[model samples]
Target: MEQDLPPVLSLDIGGTKLAAGVVTGDGRIHGWQVTPTRREEGPRQVLARLFDLGRKAVADAGEPEVAAVGISCGGPLDTATGVLGCPPHLPGWIDVPVGALAAEAFGVPSALENDATAAALGEFRYGAGRGTRTMLYLTVSTGVGGGSVIGGRLHRGAAGNGGELGHVMVRPGGRRCTCGRHGCLEAYASGTAIAERAREALATGRPSSLAAVGNPTAEDVSRAVESGDGLAREIWDETTWALGTAITDLVNVFEPELVVLGGGVTRSGALLLDPVAVAVARDAMPPAARTARIVLAELGAGVCVVGAGAVAHDLLSGKTPGKTPHA
Candidate 1:
């Protein structure tokens, strides 16, 4: 049945990179192409390049006639209107009618979705969350973000951005968050936050291997932790603490069957997952803790591409974005 669905063009817009591909219903991407976003060029020029990339992907995929187009990006967007709001990732890109523009370019219907939300769907249908009725996906990249699938359907909150899971408070009145809140999970756990914390520590002349590097990143901290650097270990512990604390609350509230961790920071693997798992197991309600399994995402960098393609498939089938297609 999946193979019966036509291919679709999938576009993923990120602050740093843009990706395009033709995706079949089986979750296979063909003729994938990626380029720097160079967002400073502004929306008009950037979108033109994105469209060109999509056309190139389609051609590289043997010029299959796609049924629809799907676009995924960081949100604060209007899914119904297919307009991007003031997404913090893409500064200066406000109220862009991306869906309409994509439809016009491809001569087909188009769907727009929050990147994390679409990633949740992609995992649910084809990756780590497969066979799950309820799942939570968290991406701990430049900033933190999340999406949920509940009862086998995507859970887009009333505002249509899904829940801002990153904003959950982990430490009262602590670090300021991008959302203008205090002590958000993102403020402590994001890759950006990790690097910032390390840099701030180094500025104080702390003795650590991180200080030897001209500029340190999250990966540097992770490596330092592996090499037994006390400063890096301290920062890493706090990062895991924030993530675990926030996830405990989520597990208690959502009672999901799986929590899939993805994004740049998660490449640290067990260093990140093991401690968070322990904290959640110890802190959350017994029933919720026992039911929830934290795991890494499988689709890797292609997640949003596959996810957007899934949205396009839903459009072609007349199914709601999060709902299961009728047999």
Candidate 2:
């Protein structure tokens, strides 16, 4: 039995940041909460604090009422059962029943999702991919992860982990990725990968203007690229090239109406988007290339919260997953 459910509480658990908010059905965040994750605290301590953050969001929303809770965390997670199974981002956390825990805390139903998958849902419901029957969302942050909506439904695939789009091979024998794969898209184009390339160039005595930061981030590399630094341009070009190659494969396979790119690396803006878009347009199959529009995610940093809220909304509204929920 359910009364009109209250506003949904959405939580995003990231390696660097913890974001929680009360989200309404209209794709707006009511009371947003954010803090550093302090990941070394381990899943137990961090999760406790994360839960506390959720409470604060609910209180701040002043709604007296959040009908359900939605959690978006980095995967390898069990979206169907709401269990987080040994997420690489949350080292040592094995099969934690996060959804059930949230349900207990809030006295309401809870849903858990992969952060990338949640981001895709957010895009589908409210962002660049809105109204599209098929779309893809890729987040190129500390690690690259992506989710797809095919035939108007989130394609969970046979492995429940959604498709690991980031694992697509680009260079075949290039950089090693977190997933222990060489030449995966994540190895070449993620924000972490960009910084790594910059550091490697510096280590090899390549002349560049990026020596000042001691430990430059991806943004630093972008700044250097814009400043006409040869080394930086090399690294940036590699990043964009890898993105272009991988997205081309994706556009060909999924034939999505839109491909939404988000995450830290996307801050490079058109430097990244233009090349990837151009490559996809030139390399993908004509039908898919013609139909797909590569674009940046409109929700920005708030996507996880909104996406999780969307998940909870669907659950509360009885929109359970099936062969194709959106269809």
Candidate 3:
């Protein structure tokens, strides 16, 4: 029966990029494709392109039929209604019925999930949290997003986005977050925040290797820090410090067995993971800290696609809503 179901089609909508893939039972992606999102184009135009991309992925994968479609995007969205609800990343998108459209386009039922929530399911099913009973997944990218699996169940909060982990106030009266909040962890630790801090520092006419970067990105800052650039190092320290502080708080509250960090920011590897791990270990409640391991996500860039596919797979398998099947 499992083999009789067609491979699932998965789509991920991000502020900066759109991705699509066909996922098999073993959690591998076939015919993966990614393109710039160009959010200024508005939802209709973007969805058209996204659907075309999905079609291309399906054709390329040579999977003649898709049993279901799964879509992953940043929230505030309603998974129950499959509507996009003014996600800050997508600017003008508001209450767009993304899942219904996907279902119509592919002639299959569709499931929608918060991108981070989908990623959590993805990592839990096939990545770093495979054998763990409880895990937290945090994505520090264009923004900071998180999802949790508690008691071996994916926890989609009442609002369906689980929690806005980035919105945790790490500094009072600090930088403003996209969610219109001040002093949130996203204000300091996200990739956008890192780049913004570097640009702000450079604007003050300080001397550093980053000065040569023109408009330095977060990656540039990490590379500069690796090369011993003092200004970059300072910005990096603050980023890691914010991550550590927020993660420490989360570890205390959730007592997860593992915290898996993913997203573009984690590409810095040890530059980001080491300091955050140290901070969580030294700062969280001893019992929580002793039981939790902080680690990099094994799924890397394809996590969301696989996650969305996993969601679709559950649908085909007749799994009940809000239930997570064990790995």
Candidate 4:
């Protein structure tokens, strides 16, 4: 199908899954594909599978050819260099030149972006943050990740990882964070953290619905909360508290018009959004709280793909430096 904007191939790499799609200018995705990441296979093997998935998406998209390739993954990756550093989620994946590889494989230039940063752009351009001048986005999944759009521009931060909103300290000396901090928001609010807290509670002989499952996930905890499980509620409440505390700080600092939450954990819907919104409303600085509305992301799963495609579109349109090729 002919598109107003040239279609681009976009890929999202997560520790647990890899997704690819052809994204058009309207932020719509065609030929979406997803598969288990199986990180144990290591970077080289996993990337081979990811590239294969991209090819499948392209074929399914039925486009004559992709204009460019865009990649989204966890940081600390160097977007300028397209190198994947050691992300906690994908342990041992270090210094891999993902962009160059994609460029070579597809015979087109490629751009790499931090996954959360791309999602922020996606939300700002076409999702929940559309029509908003300033926005904050957080994806609370395997780990907490964040990005922001300030003054209608994507903020890449000084290091190019964008703002590490997830690293905002929520508790001084509480749970250990993957970044080695005592109590960052990710330590308390990530899906991994929620599951860990629930499992720990069950280990202490606490009576709860989660105890029935040998290994409960964040989704399991959310389900338990829906059924009025006390232990699950406790974990969910703490998760919301950490998120609210951190977001309150961000709202005070950025004063964004909207804060959009996405990722797998957000599948809990109002069970997660209502409390966080209430806490931010009740606790954030008055002016900032009044302007900021907490909302769920409109692009449920293909956000990063569309965001990366947007970046590719920008590169092609000369909005970004064309270090990469359009064809």
Candidate 5:
């Protein structure tokens, strides 16, 4: 395995599940496997399962050898040191050396990247942002994460957290965000935020179809909106507005040629995109607004895995940096 090599193993670690696969040069997944995180089992247990997932993926892919391992997970993680710091989403997972552990388990080198950054790379290499020198990617799921391709390269921030795009202010003082900040874009636009807003609306005894659906999730809200439920429509509208505002800010700062929006919330598709696009066009600085195209990511749920594979491929080829050897 070498850094110049083309294909590699990819793994995606989420608060809820773990996914792994062999990502080929063509960006296709071979022997993809996924399982719940079972956080109650603790970090060590979770990593054991996560490593098993890699073995399964490798066996399934039938590739006797893989050049490297690419791992994608949430932050605040130290990609340079391959240590996962205290990520708020994954409580109790403190200072875990995930990248080094994966390398040892698999007997190959590995590279670590924030899941969002990996997604950005995956999109840049194989998805909607392909061929673009400057691109932005956001995953609006349990939380909002941002990453960018600047100067045709993934912009690894000084701390190796990539970019904390979700922390950007959209509402200023509207809701409490997970980042201990008030009214961040994540507080208003993420799937969790959408469901929370809908639940709050229901708690107010608002007349809506959502009440009938117990424990309404973001998907429920989307359905309600489609069915003309005013409550659902209102929440959905606000979500899009927050996304628009935050993205507009990013556009003004990054001047990226393309903005790729992914994650569970993006399933709303044109409903979500059209408005955000309009806002950026209308509000972003003239030059940035002129060339920026806001679109959905093409990799879908398999993005993190493929992105990890790309990073692993890079590591094997020596294109990656900041990977410390495992003990």
Candidate 6:
């Protein structure tokens, strides 16, 4: 019956990119399109382009009649009202009524969701978390973020941002986080943090391959670690340590069946996963540790697109966007 459901138009708005696609109930994406966000254009122009991109996707997919529109974006948003608060990634775009605009453009209902929270549902319903009843998804990209699926239901906490998992403090008074906190997991484990740490070490005249890079990035640090660069290895170790420590805390608190790591930083693969898995296994309470499995996300770059589509599907089916039937 799900396969007979109409395709949903999915749009993902990120600071750097905008992606659009048509997704069917089987969780496959069609007519995927991506373009640079050029966010400086601000919301009006950017949203118009995003809507056109969605139209293009529908035409390309040969499905002109989508049932609903689903949007995913970085948040501090009010999902119930579909209003985007001033997200740090999109400066000056405050209190935009994105859901109403999308529904007007497409002549259908729409649902807006926090990008990370959407990705959690995406993975849970279609990817790595397909069979799991309880899961946690952490995106360690430009910044760290996360969401949870607990007891077969997506958990959007009271504030509706699905819990700020990245803000959990790891060190009492270490590096400053974007949230203005000290020693948060984001300050230590995000891709931006990894790259910044490498650059700072190079500034001290440390010898390493990363110094040769004009502007080192997290990927550069990962590559340098693979090549046996001492300074890069140190930074990598600290990144993994911060992630493992924070995840250990989450495991103890939630006891999720799986912890799925997504986003650009997770491309490091075993280099990132192995250390974190080892730490959790070695340090977490035995019962929780034994129950949790750590793995990389399967959806990769298209995660938010697919996740938003899932939300639309739920909307059309008269189900709460993030809740499973069992819940």
C-alpha lDDT values of all predictions: 0.92, 0.86, 0.90, 0.90, 0.87, 0.92
Candidate 2 least-lDDT 10 residues:
318-327
| Residue-level lDDT tens digits of model 4 in 1-327 | 124788999999987889999998888899999999999999889999999999999999998899988899989988788888888789888798888888888888788889999998998998998899999999998889989999988888889899988999999999999899999999999999999999899999989988888899999999999999999999999999999999999999999999999989999999999999999999999999999999999988888998888877766765543235335
Winner on lDDT (5 vs 6): 6
Q: For model 3, where is the 10-residue window of minimal lDDT?
A: 318-327
lDDT tens readout by residue for model 5, 210-261: 8999999998998888889999999989998999999999999999999999
Off by over 4 Å in 4: 1-3, 321-327
Worst window of 10 by summed lDDT in candidate 4: 318-327
| Number of colliding residue pairs in model 3 | 0
Return the clash pairs for model 1, or none: none
lDDT of 3 at 292: 95
Candidate 2 lDDT over 110-228, as tens digits, reads 88888898888888887888789989999998888989988777777777777888999998888888888799999998888889888988998866889877888999999998889
Compared with the true structure, model 1 gives a TM-score of 0.97
Off by over 4 Å in 5: 1-4, 322-327
TM-score of each: 0.97, 0.94, 0.93, 0.94, 0.96, 0.97
lDDT of 3 by residue, 130-188 (tens): 88989999998888898999897778888678887788899988998877889899999
For all candidates, what are the clash counts? 0, 0, 0, 0, 6, 0
Candidate 6 lDDT over 23-142, as tens digits, reads 999989999999999899999999999999999999999996998998999999888878899999999999998888888888888888999999999999999999999999999999
